[model samples]
Target: MSDTLIDPPADGPTERPLPLRPALEAVLMVADQPLDSVALATAVGHPVEDVVAALQTLAEQYDEQDRGFELRHVAGGWRYYTREAYAPAVEKFVLEGQQARLTQAALETLAVVAYQQPVSRARVSAVRGVNVDGVMRTLLTRGLVEEAGQDVGTGAHLYRTTGYFLERIGVSSLDELPELAPYLPDMEDLEDELERVGGFQTRPDEQPGDQPGAATPTEETP
Candidate 1:
């Protein structure tokens, strides 16, 4: 009896290469802004901890390189940026004619929405001291604001900023929104504007918070 021996194929699975931390670093190093661990994890299909460790390692390497740029954690994530010392030089190349100047109406509407997200058009109009229908359209079209949804009580469409806004402003989320106090007029000064427009208020004697009518912006990127 002649017995023939057959070769068996490979086992259950082929081995894959381990995750390369340096590759992850290279990807993030060239990004315009910081990347969150979640984003990195998704890209590499690895645990967030792994991605974070890789980022930390890469950051140190860049530091040791003494390049004109470094990694920084901002808006609840990490991003590569030019060294502060090279700001002037970098600005000359990146900021030339690339700056976007928001219109007054857009700014006002954005301010209202940023402060009072999920706010309705009527509320924004109430705070701006003018009809905001047109301005809301502009903000939406410009990708600065979007419809959050309908309010149960009035069924009015709620509005908020888009991811584009977060990226545009170099923030990870609305929580990172800048404090409006410095940019906003005081309650006493805004009284005329508020009364004339007829919007909600945080307190009888204070401006509304960053909510529909009252709240504040903090660094809580999602």
Candidate 2:
């Protein structure tokens, strides 16, 4: 064999492309949010018709095969969801895991946020009487809490319990969040605690209980 140095072609392919279905699955697996047809098509470098067909076929195959997870199209987008038939198993697994793992402090912090949503981390910390940054990050990572908005006065990011949190707790709304309030001090004491910590006291009237929307993630990501 002759010794030689080779220069690669600059304009040719860099890597072998994945087939359409595999590519779509790969993208959806990593997606934290639903992807619409146009996005999926652009990603897989396929036509929209082909993408839609592949998605439908995949959905049917999953259904027929009785898979634990499924491909679903909702709110003008497509994503992977736990198969409804398997939700109890998944929920049991998740709730059991959560119960085993979440610490007492985390549970307390979660309760604070649950009862006082759109709440700032500062407020949660003040309520808990300790800095809750790390614990809050854990909650965020576990999908138990999520950024709702920001405090208009201080600009601190506010967070709320996610739909996943509600699902795990077996509640349709915060109104049904039980056992925390009785253990907490009376409203007068709680208001004093808020005032002492320079935090806002979330009003009961603003709890969104009356409107009680399902803590459902079917339409969007938590």
lDDT per residue for candidate 1 within 107-142, as digits (tens), equals 767888887777766566555655565566557656
TM-score of 2: 0.47
Candidate 1, which ten residues in sequence have the lowest lDDT sum? 202-211
Report the C-alpha lDDT of model 2 over 169-206, residue by residue, as the tens digit.
78898788676666654433555555554423432211
Q: Which regions in candidate 2 have their CA more than 4 angstroms from the true location?
A: 1-10, 13-16, 102-144, 149-222
What's the C-alpha lDDT at position 83 in model 1? 83
Question: Candidate 1 at residue 54, lDDT?
Answer: 78
Report every candidate's CA lDDT: 0.64, 0.71
Clash pairs (backbone) in predicted model 1: 34-78, 34-79, 115-210, 116-211, 175-218, 209-214, 209-215, 210-215
